[model samples]
Target chain A: MASNLRSPLARVRGLGSAKDGTGHWWAQRLTALALIPLTLWFVAGVLGHVGADYAEVRAWIGHPVTAGLFLLLIGATFYHAALGVQVVIEDYVHNEWAKLASLLTVKAALLILGLAAALAVLSILFD
Target chain B: MSAQDEAASDPKARRPLSPHLQVYRPQLTSALSIFHRITGIALAVGTLLLVWWLVAAAAGPEAYAAASGFIGSWLGLFLLLGWSAALFYHLANGIRHLVWDAGYGFELPTVYASGWAVVIVTGALTLLAWIVGLVAW
Candidate 1:
């Protein structure tokens, strides 16, 4: 190797000089992994609604098991999107101020949308 | 006047550090960055479609029928196909990232090879999903 005399720690132990962040990378993947089965279930549930009437749709959501699954899907998906979008802004937005601003904006938007959707689903199933 | 001469300028200020993308030929790392960005945008827009589907389903039969009708259109089908591909690609790539985090694919050749693998696997899965979807219809 080019630096055979150096220890392996020298090559990797303190490489954070760039102030680089890894949480965003890790979180995105984690959430995606979580969403896999949830997403599949969601697609199937929607497919089940193909020709169902309004009451049928309502009744489906009203089922405790379905409502619980739907909520899990919503929460996981929005959280996943928020994490993914944060990384996108970090990679593309070169301007520091603009990057931070855009990141916050995406986070807030996802949070609001995710909560709103969850509430809507809950209200339907509950009342 | 009391300060010493500032003749000793910063030694590292002008020295070259690590090579950047500008210096190297395109590689998988660069390609991964681009792929991540594209997938991120796709996910964002795809979320809107999800929200719309939910709203329509929640609204009532007429609204759900209208939305589903639009979804049945050729344009809707095309978009759905694209979105499904995006979802699968992102999912496969996410697994790649996790593997990478644990430091398995760090070798130069392995990096590129796995990148190609990700692409191939994502396409295969997308096609599989569509095939399954067709059977359902």
Candidate 2:
């Protein structure tokens, strides 16, 4: 009962092609591209607000444009960081279960923290 | 056990392992590539500080003061300085990666040159940021 399905080359390659190739790679690069300008803007904005009081800092965050951009920065920075860290874990973590646990932890932390940061910005903007 | 199973379970089996860092002479290009990953992880962990500051600011003046106090302290300043440098290095090297993705800068000389540029740019940006921060404070 020989079923001729996959070609010899495909059979030889085995499960290597099962993974979502290039998606992670492309996502990492795309997020990096988005961060370039966002990071520069963030650095400049922080520098401009140096030595300011809490009220002044809150006021700065409360601005419509600044809050919007800050939200964008939070999202991109966390997402990019998660993707980058996932690769490091996958490469270095030898134990399969540990690797899975770590990957899950990193992603969960990023999601929770990203949401919290965004909410903080929103609260300031509305207050 | 079957021969196939025995072969699969054999400890002495020869399989391809990734080239270890010890095998290669450390070059600027290789060092920068490794540093890129290290800084990326640092930046990831450093995002917690950013989140804490934002939450504190949103919470109230007292919370904000507490957070700012820690950030203004010597140890906090040191960590922040390191974080800022990591951020800049990761950002610069990330741009170099984007260029590589665009199908350029693969030439050996160009790669090495870009690696050094990332290092120099990271240093300059970090120094400039600290200078501005200190002067403004």
Candidate 3:
């Protein structure tokens, strides 16, 4: 032990929480709360159309209200999924570089794929 | 003092972590927690399926047939079944999590009870959805 007599809090004065985890955590929950109802609605809609043909399915999904909610579902789902997976990678992946690469890959895939889905919804709405 | 000790002494060390998941014996609480993450990741991957279905719809009826055909196949049904169950489980367990987040339900009995409730709700909802799917066709 050194002869210095600095207080523990003072010794670590500048070091603090990363401060991002709280936002991530809160957002996860908020998105989750949003998903509860959205998911039920979507699932009910899907279950109702179990064996419907393309035309029938399109008719249901093409409704303005359905499309709007669908967009919200897609947005919330992807953002929530990205945050969740990022935490998983951070937790299990030991190597920093591999962790970083995988994290970026996962985020990118989700973002692009989600955008594609959103565009698909918009196309469905317009066409 | 080796490297770990040196790391311990350094305040600038970004993150020092240990194998937390491995060291603990699996308890019901912990098991439920792990399943939450596992189901979460599964649902995340399932979004690709969602994207494919939507893109197929956007592409038109022929492409949509391919997507629906694949989804209507045995393998697709199996995966959809899994995804649905995972969805239900994750949703129920996630609500439990939010309840905990709100600083309630910390009691051990309540935790275990809620875990079982989530399991029951998942099973029932999944069964109900499938029934509706099959009958509404």
Candidate 4:
């Protein structure tokens, strides 16, 4: 009687379910790795802004290198954050509808923040 | 064993248990998960601060000066302190994740020890950075 039906394990083992989790897991870590240096640079950059007036801050960020790095840091930080929070919400939210809503909300907010930061950096560079 | 006793004696015969988060101890892994959530929230809030700074800078000198002064106050300093800790904690945890990725530190003792170490090191670094910042000022 037990052998009458195909085993669920056999159906799942060779299929995509087991393997696909790794992509999301790997992506989270990959973004984490990229962020370490970028975060360090961003910290130091903020430190440099200490006591700087409007013009001084603007000039520093206006430099092409600083602007470029600022954009990179912002982009990577938000990307990493979105992935991290998505996992947390998925794990804890429990309700299916709530989890889906949270995941979408987080991603949308991340995109908006990233774009806003990018635009801010460009505004400084061009000014 | 009697039928009632037999049912009670067999752990495997029990219905599926409730989820782990509701029942588990506050172990290192759980603590780390909480930390990750907290840091994520802090980072989200801190992004608003970043936007504020940028907007002020873009607006002009007088506006920027007001914003700059506001951020330099004690309240601003306290907020910065929190932001710095979040940054460092997240950074250290990210490195820990990387180490785990290389197939190392999976032993139970090592995982717990490293988790505490990440917390300590992040705190220390954040303090040192703030100290240096003040001294430089």
**What does the lDDT come to for candidate 1?**
0.75
Model 4 vs. true fold: TM: 0.80
> What is the C-alpha local distance difference test score of each model?
0.75, 0.90, 0.89, 0.79
Count of backbone collisions within predicted model 1 = 0
For candidate 4, the lDDT comes to 0.79
Candidate 2: where are CA atoms >4 Å away? A1-18, B1-16
Ranking of candidates on DockQ, top first: 2, 3, 4, 1
lDDT of 3 by residue, B1-137 (tens): 89988985675886835436557678878788889999999999898789999999889999999999999899998999999999999999999999999999999899999999998999999999888887875
State how far residue B83 of model 4 sits from its true place (Å): 1.5
Candidate 2's TM-score reads: 0.89
lDDT per residue as tens, model 3, A46-104: 88788889888888778899999999999999999998999999887867789999999
List fnat, each candidate: 0.37, 0.90, 0.88, 0.55
lDDT of 2 by residue, A1-127 (tens): 1686777566545543536556677788888999999999999999999899988999999999999999999999999989989999988886788999999999999999999999999999999
Number of the top candidate by TM-score?
2
What is candidate 3's DockQ? 0.74
Q: In candidate 4, residue B25 scores what lDDT?
A: 74
**Which residue window of length 10 is worst by lDDT in model 2 chain A?**
A9-18
State how far residue B46 of model 2 sits from its true place (Å).
Answer: 0.2
Q: Which pairs of residues collide in candidate 4?
A: none
Candidate 3 regions exceeding 4 Å error are A1-16, A19-21, B1-5, B8-25
* Candidate 1, A1-127: lDDT as tens digits: 6656666555444443334445555566677778878877876776566556667878898788998998988888998888777766776686778998998988888887787778767877876
